[model samples]
Target: MLILQSVAGLLILPSLAWAISEDRKKARPRIAAVGVVSQLVVALMLEG
Candidate 1:
């Protein structure tokens, strides 16, 4: 759980940056999808 939390925190940076974006809304979704997948991978690694 702790490892998941830390990995989630790392993923938050890109989202926060995305949130701050004014004109790049379209690209944010793609970036977020990638972030989610990355977090999933991190969690999987912890489980394995």
Candidate 2:
């Protein structure tokens, strides 16, 4: 479970970067970042 959460965090970072770079829309990047942060938080919670 912990390993899966870590992998999810790793996957989300690149996707967030890609979304921020490719999309010109203002709200998309914010949404992507929020997703990334949410993943990180979940991962940390699981680890803790």
Candidate 3:
């Protein structure tokens, strides 16, 4: 779980930087998708 969270955080960090640099409204969906996938990964890891 910790590893999965760490990986997700690392992935999110770049997207967050990009989102901050550009218009957030346009990047919302992309960010959300990343979040969703990260959550799914964490869930799968925990279940397995």
Candidate 4:
């Protein structure tokens, strides 16, 4: 689970960078949503 979270974090990095650099304005909100969800998942993983 920890490894999966780390891999997800790693994957998000480059995609986030591209989103920041590219013209994908619509993707920003979706990215933010994913980030929030990921944080919640991580919290659940840690607490459990």
Candidate 5:
């Protein structure tokens, strides 16, 4: 579980960087939402 969480965290880093680099201001919110959902899914999957 800890390993999964760590891997999830690592995976988010590139998405975060991509979000920051995006010139389309509108896409940021979507990217952030995806990131949040991804974390929640991983957490729930691990916890349950």
Candidate 6:
């Protein structure tokens, strides 16, 4: 359950940051997606 929560947070936080950002023009969806993917990859690598 803890691990699941951690993963969910990793996925959701970046999206939430982008969603609530004041500068929508600067926070492109592609950048946010890339950040999320990179974070997930790093997390998985650390877990191993």
All models: lDDT? 0.76, 0.72, 0.73, 0.73, 0.73, 0.82
Candidate 4 all-Cα RMSD: 5.4
Residues 1-48, model 3: lDDT tens digits: 997887778678767776677575565667667876887788789989
**Candidate 5 runs further than 4 Å off:** 1-27
Please write out the lDDT profile of model 4 over residues 17-48, one tens digit for every residue: 76677567646667766876787798779979
RMSD of each: 3.3, 5.0, 4.7, 5.4, 4.5, 1.9
In terms of lDDT, the poorest run of 10 residues in model 1 is 23-32
lDDT of 1 by residue, 6-39 (tens): 7777778776877788867466577677877877
Query: TM-scores of the models, in the given order?
Result: 0.45, 0.49, 0.44, 0.44, 0.45, 0.65
- Candidate 4 Cα lDDT to native: 0.73
lDDT score for residue 40 of model 4: 70
For candidate 5, the TM-score is 0.45
Please give me the total number of clashing residue pairs in predicted model 5.
0
Candidate 6 TM-score, true structure as reference: 0.65
Worst 10 residues of 2 by lDDT: 22-31
lDDT of 1 at 9: 77
Write candidate 6's Cα lDDT for 1-48 as tens digits.
998998789778877887888987787778777877888799789989
Model 1 misplaced stretches (Cα beyond 4 Å) = 1-27
lDDT of 5 by residue, 1-48 (tens): 988877777677656676678574555666777877788798789899
Please name the candidate that would achieve the greatest lDDT relative to the true structure. 6
TM-score of 3: 0.44
